[model samples]
Target: MLTVLMLGDSLVEWGDWPSLLPEVAVINRGIAGEMTEELSARLMDEIDACPDPDAVLIQSGTNNLLFGYILFPTMLITMLQRLRLCYPSVPLIVNSLMPMPIVAPHDLEQINRELAVAAAATENCHFLDTVGPFQEQCLPITHPGFLNDQVHLSTRGYQVWAATIKGLLEQLFPGKLPG
Candidate 1:
């Protein structure tokens, strides 16, 4: 079975990944209110627990936006680097921060852009844009797919996320995971 480590903040913590991707062995290492520093602190232990993950999917930074953190880009790069150090050969999918109505659209775009560049610079890392499908054109506001709160995801939102990841997995590993 393909073993994947899903890591991040609440976006990762709140998902029912086992049910969403029943075909693979998914280890959810998401914490509800984690920032990059907390993630960095616990990352080694999380990876050590699953010594040989086939891939790692990461989605974070929303909390940073929520709390008005300024060093997002640097911390994000650090987070990606740490993951590479632990699993150099493993595919690391660094998901873009989801759109948040509370944060300005331009700010979110900037963060996502920087994240894309950072992910590209790292070996074995892929930046997955989880924003475009969920938000309107160039707007920070989410479409109707999000939960009523407009921050967290709804069931349909999760389904959309799973389908997107599933497609990428199919493309990346071909027959390794069941449809």
Candidate 2:
């Protein structure tokens, strides 16, 4: 069976991947209002539960950037490095943080985008750009079709996510769920 460990804050939990992916084991480790430090602290438990995940989808750090002083890019790199060290062979897919119109383009969302781009340059880490669908015609937007909050996603929001992941399935695992 294909197993995937997903870790993040509420944004990660918003997707109904569990019900949507019955064929695959989707372990969601999303805790509302969590920061990168909190996630890093819980790394051991997550890794323990995800002993052999075919892939790991990470959608975190919005809370961190919104609340903490750590640079978003550095926090992302830290998370990726830690996860990579835990399971070097596991396919790592870092889901980009959603867009927030209330927060300026230069704030958390922008930092998150930069982090995604930076992660894309590294090995074994696929940085998925979230701004693509969550935005309105290439601009920052907060529509019910995309987000429940500045960061969280509604059902429609998850639809966009599902579409993105579906396209990546072929490359992440031929004829298999990307998780």
Candidate 3:
């Protein structure tokens, strides 16, 4: 089975990855309430435990935004750089921060744009644009993609996220992932 190291905050931590991606072996190193900086700090340790993985998936920055830390892309890029240094050829998938009711749409867009630029500039890195898909799936409802707190994801939200991930994985690994 293909193994992937998933790192980040609550979004990553809360995912039932085994259920979400039954075909892949997932090493989830997600910490609830963790910010980008914290994730960067602990990244090496997380990687050390796993040693090697076919790919790495990161979903972070929402806590940073919630704590009013808008300049998180710099840290995220640093984390990606560290990952590249460790696993030169491994695919690094950077998941865009999902839109939340608490954050202004423009602000979220700007942050995602910065993240996309960073991912594009990095070798062997891919950015998963979850914004449009989430928006499209949860249309007409103000916050169907999120829980009541508007920060955590709802069941429907996770389904959308999982579908996006599955599609990306299939594209990246081809016939490796089951249909």
Candidate 4:
């Protein structure tokens, strides 16, 4: 079975990916209220433990923005570089920051753009633009019952997220999942 390591903050911590992608084994290393710097510090050890993941999924930086840090792009890039150093060949899927009710759409858009560009520029890395789909459910004006709170996803949200990433995973590593 394919093993995917997911690392991030509360959004990732609350997800139940094993249930969502039954074909693959998911190792979640998410910690609630974790900032980018903290995640960076723990990343090398986490990757060392996994050592051979088919892919790594990350969705951090929200807390950095929430805590009033202006260095999100730099921090995120550093984290990606660290991951690359640890697992040079493993595919890294960088999911865009989910839309939050409190953060301005324009500001969030900028951060997502920065992350997308960085991921695209990195070797063996790809950006998963989840903002639009998530906005369809999480945005206050377009809420479709996917998010429990303004920040965290509900069960339905996790389902959506899983489906979205599954498609990309299949594309990136076709036939890796067994029946």
Candidate 5:
């Protein structure tokens, strides 16, 4: 099974990754309410714990937004640089901030734009933009993607996220991952 090291905040921590991606070995290093700066600070330790992962996926910055740090990509870019140094040949997947009721759409768009740019500039890095997929999947009022807190994801939301990850992994690894 392909091993993926996932790092970030609650989104990564709370996910039932083993069940979500049954075919892969997921090493989740997520801390709830963690900010970009905090993640950067402990990033090395996290990577050290999982010395030889096939890939790394990061989904941070939402907590930073809650703390009113709009331009989080600056710190995120720095963190990505460090990650590249640690895992030069491994594929790095950077997840865009999901659209939430708390953040304005424009601000989310701007943040995702910067994230996309950062991923594009990094070698072997891939960007996963979830805004459109989430929006499309949660169109029905009864099937809202977010939990009651309007920040965390609901089951439907996770399905969308998992599907997206699976698709990307398939592309990155070809037939290595089960369909």
Candidate 6:
């Protein structure tokens, strides 16, 4: 019985994947309207609340793009560094910030992919790309379930996300995050 903590936005929590999986003891610590800074500000609370998870899945930083003031990659690097310092030995799964609805200057998803790649290059960080319908071909996201809002996951959207990431989740975790 291993514990897995999911930290990020609604994306990590939309489908209640954590709760659905009983064996892994998943924790979804996603705040609906939070960015990396907000997550950083409350890191201790988030970390302390989980059930000593053996793995931590981090999918943050999309909201920062909405603000239009920061670069996604740099912010991701900073975030990864902080998390690493906090939990140096725990396995880290850095999910790419999901793509948003089609828009300029806010093509946050792809940028986050780049950041995810960079983060994966680090010793303990591994990037998880959630660029499926969550983004239009790696650019903007699409959500048929939410009347095309694209950013948020409809039930179907969450299903798609679960399908895409399920393999990876199983690969690293080995039968933890249920299919």
Best by lDDT: 5
The local lDDT score (0 to 100) that residue 122 gets in candidate 3 is: 91
Put down candidate 3 lDDT per residue, 1-179, tens digits, no spaces: 88999998989889888988889898888899998988988989987897789999999999988888999999888899989999999999999999888899999999999999989989999999999899889753764989889989888888889889888988999999866
**What C-alpha lDDT do the candidate models reach, one value each?**
0.80, 0.71, 0.90, 0.82, 0.91, 0.65
Q: Is candidate 1 or candidate 4 better by lDDT?
A: 4
Task: Please rank every candidate by lDDT, starting with the best.
Answer: 5, 3, 4, 1, 2, 6
Candidate 6 residues lying further than 4 Å off, grouped into runs, are 18-23, 104-106, 132-147, 175-179
Every candidate's CA RMSD: 2.7, 3.3, 1.4, 2.1, 0.9, 3.8
The positional error of residue 28 in candidate 4, measured at the CA in angstroms, is: 0.4
Error of 6 at 149 (Å): 2.9
Ten-residue region with minimum lDDT total, candidate 3: 134-143
Choose 4 or 6, whichever is better by TM-score: 4
Which digits, one per residue and each the tens of the lDDT, describe model 1 over residues 48-156? 8988988999887778877888577688788788888888899999888877666689888888898889889999888888776665333334435566676787776
**Can you write out model 6's per-residue Cα lDDT over 1-179, one digit (the tens) per residue?**
66678878766656577534544566778888788777777877876676366878777766676676456566666766766777888778877655545435346645765776767666777777766545443322343533365567666556656555555657777765544
Judge candidate 2 against the unseen true structure and give its global Cα lDDT, from 0 to 1.
Answer: 0.71
Judged by whole-model lDDT over C-alpha atoms, candidate 3 comes out at: 0.90
TM-score of each: 0.90, 0.82, 0.96, 0.90, 0.97, 0.76
In model 3, the runs with Cα more than 4 Å from the true position are 140-143
Per candidate, the number of residue pairs that clash is: 0, 0, 0, 0, 0, 4
Q: What's the distance in Å from true for residue 115, model 5?
A: 0.6
Model 2 segments more than 4 A misplaced: 68-70, 136-143, 146-149
Local accuracy of candidate 5 as per-residue lDDT tens digits, 4-90: 999999999999998889988999899999998899999999988999999999999999987888777988888889889999999
